[model samples]
Target: MRPNIVLFGDSITEQSFRYGGWGASLADAYSRKADVLVRGYGGYNTRWALFLLHHLFPLDSKKPPVATTIFFGANDAALLGRTSERQHVPIEEYKENLGKIVNHLKECSPTMLIVLITPPPIDEEGRMEYARATYGEKAMTSPERTNEVAGVYARGCVELARELDLRSINLWSKMQETDGWQKKYLSDGLHLTPEGNAVVFREVARVFCEAWLSAAEMPYDFPHHSEIDGKNPEKAFQQKCL
Candidate 1:
């Protein structure tokens, strides 16, 4: 069976199959090598996501993914008393919840590679503009998230990954290294633009390659068409174990 690479997280992950999304890019990158599965929940925080582990990564499953990316924290970092406070999760709890998730995944398969991805920085102005455009007079005056708070969560995610000895992508820091990232990376101050998705794709691909899942190195599922003799196609088909 082909190996599976699961992408687990929030809206960013849910929308990853969209045009030019990071998840879609991964699917293309790992084509014929591994199955890139999406297990994303939009607007979900770690607190809520924790409950889904048993169902999503069941211990009894005959096939477990070779790798999984845990990409959350954006919604959890939502500031208290803001319009999105309903989704807010305290930083401490967020870290603990992530720990539980990682632990569960580890229990599912000790060898499964786990990658923690820090949330992206927020663009407050962009968020406000989005809120105004989407909600009009009903929109809240203040932004629901801030870059500073997102940084705190990102730091926590990185630290947790370090403590657990897993690979992590510090998206919060990486994006800001480029000037004008607010407009270039973020589409609605929270969601990612195609460029932002490219950044994610590049980082994830690098990690996957490092983990020995390089697309160029992995074998395809079936025999190549070129290997089949048109006059005697059954010969090639019978040679493959599948």
Candidate 2:
């Protein structure tokens, strides 16, 4: 079977299969080399995601994914007392939950490549506008997330990655490096725009290529069509095994 890469996260990941999304870009990039699977859950935080580890990456599974991305914290960073407080997970617990997730995946396969992605910066104005547009009179007066608080979560995610010696993308920092990122990268203060997705895809592809999963180096699951003789097409596939 072709090796698979799993994108495990929250709504950003759940919507990653959408047109022009980062996950879809990865799928296209790794086409014919490895399968890219999405395991995203909308509105989920690390605390809630902890419950899914056992089922998503069964420890006893013989064919564990070769690589997996753990991208949470956006929802976890939701401000307390706000409309999204229900999704808030204390900072310390968020880190702990992430640690648990990484440990679980490690137990499943010590060599599996694990990449952690920090929450992106939040745009209060954009969030407020989105809330108002979506909820009207029910919208909260203040944004449910703030860039400052999201930065705290982002820092925690990076520090945790360092402590665990795993790869990570500091998206919060990266996106902000570019001026006007609020509108350029984010569509709803939190979620990514097409440009934002491009940034993710570029970073992820670079990391995967550096970590020995370069599409150029990976072998296709089936022989190239050029190898098949029209007169005896079966010959080309005779020795191939799934």
Candidate 3:
């Protein structure tokens, strides 16, 4: 059976299978060589995610994923006692939760490769302004999530990855390296635009190539359909496939 590459995260991950998304890109790249599973829970924080992990993952996995990307923090970074407080988790707790996740995955499958993904930077001004436009000033309860706060969580993510000796992708920092990255990368201030997805796809592909799969060395399951002899399909498949 093909190995699995799991995508576990929040809204961004939930939408990752959409057109021009990172999940789709991975699936396309792996094709017949592996399976890509997207397990993104929208509006969920680390605390909630921890509860769900038990159900989705076997403690003693008979089939561990070849790789899994844990992308969260966007919802967890929500301001305390604010509009998004329901999803808010303290930075300390967020850090601990991340560690717990890593440990749990490791315990289940020691050899499973894990990638911790920091949430992509949010467009604070753009998000706030959009909220005001939709809900009006009075209806706008709070600046639930801000770029400044997200930066803190992002840092924590990277630092924790180092401490645990796991691979990581700091989308928060990477997205900011470019000018007007907010406008190009973020769609609704939090979710990724197509351009943002492309950015992520490139990074994921890089990791897969550098660490997991060697593109040039790996072969497809069978010969290309075009190469099959139309007059003798089964014979062609038998000879070429083997």
TM-score of each: 0.97, 0.96, 0.92
Model 2 residue 35 lDDT?
93
Total backbone clashes of candidate 1, pairs 3 or more residues apart or in separate chains? 0
Query: Residue-wise lDDT of candidate 3 within 1-242, one digit each (tens)?
Result: 77888999999999998978989988888887888998999999999999988777888678888888999999999988778888999999999999999998998798888889998898987688778877886655556788989999999999999999988899999999999998899886888889999999888778767776644556777877887889878876787565
Q: Compute the lDDT of residue 67 as modeled in candidate 1.
A: 95
Q: All predictions: root-mean-square deviation over Cα? A: 1.1, 1.4, 1.9
Off by over 4 Å in 3: 239-242
lDDT (10s digit) by residue, model 2, range 26-98: 9999999899999999999999999999999999999999999999999999989998999999999999999
Model 1 residue 83 CA deviation in Å = 0.7
Worst ten-residue run, lDDT, model 2? 233-242
Maximum-TM-score candidate: 1
For candidate 2, give the lDDT of residue 30: 94
Model 3 steric clash pairs:
none
